[model samples]
Target: MTYGYIGSMRTRSGRRDDVVAILLSAAGSLRELGCRSYVVGLAADDPDTIVVTEVWESKEHHDASLRSPGAKEAIAAAMPMLTGEFTSRETTVVGGLGV
Candidate 1:
């Protein structure tokens, strides 16, 4: 089954742009690891909020991708700008626009 991850991340004040750039720059690496899509979006009214949506080939693929060197590096690169906690949801893709 396909796997999906949707999450909201809050960056330090004025740091959302930095976080988005890091995610965008790392997209190619994630795609190579079986990530079908990794999209980053900015919140319309919250400058510090970022929305992340991801689709992976499978749960295993997504988990394994996090273990890849590239993923670890990407996480580390974005860590500094992150603030507070993140909210995430995991789902099984039954049918959807991108599925």
Candidate 2:
């Protein structure tokens, strides 16, 4: 099944730029890993909060990318900028529903 992931993160004090840079690098790495779509956007009302949304061709592809060295390294680099625990959720696309 096609897979999607949503991740939410909050940046530490004075780390918004660092976090954004990390996310940009991570997005590029995810694209190289065959992600169908990847987006990292900051919350308009809260500059410290970031939301990362990604879609993969399949669950297997997503899982494999998560286990890749590049992904791990990117995550590690982003960790220090985090203010609190990140939250993530994975889901399978059931229907487009013509949004």
Backbone clashes for every candidate come to 0, 0
Tens-place lDDT per residue, model 2, 1-99, is: 778889889988788888788768767666667687888888898778898888888888888997998778877887888888678999886656321
Model 1 lDDT at residue 80: 85
Q: Model 2: residues >4 Å from true position, as ranges?
A: 94-99
Reference-based lDDT, each prediction: 0.87, 0.80
Best by lDDT: 1
Q: What's the TM-score of every candidate structure?
A: 0.91, 0.81
The candidate that achieves the highest TM-score relative to the unseen native structure: 1
lDDT of 2: 0.80
Candidate 1 wrong stretches, greater than 4 Å: none
Question: What value of lDDT does candidate 1 attain over all alpha carbons?
Answer: 0.87
Q: What TM-score would candidate 1 get against the native?
A: 0.91
What does candidate 1's lDDT look like per residue over 7-96, in tens digits?
999999888888888888878777778888788999898889999999999989999988888778889988988986799999987776
Model 1, residue pairs in steric clash: none
lDDT of 1 at 43: 82
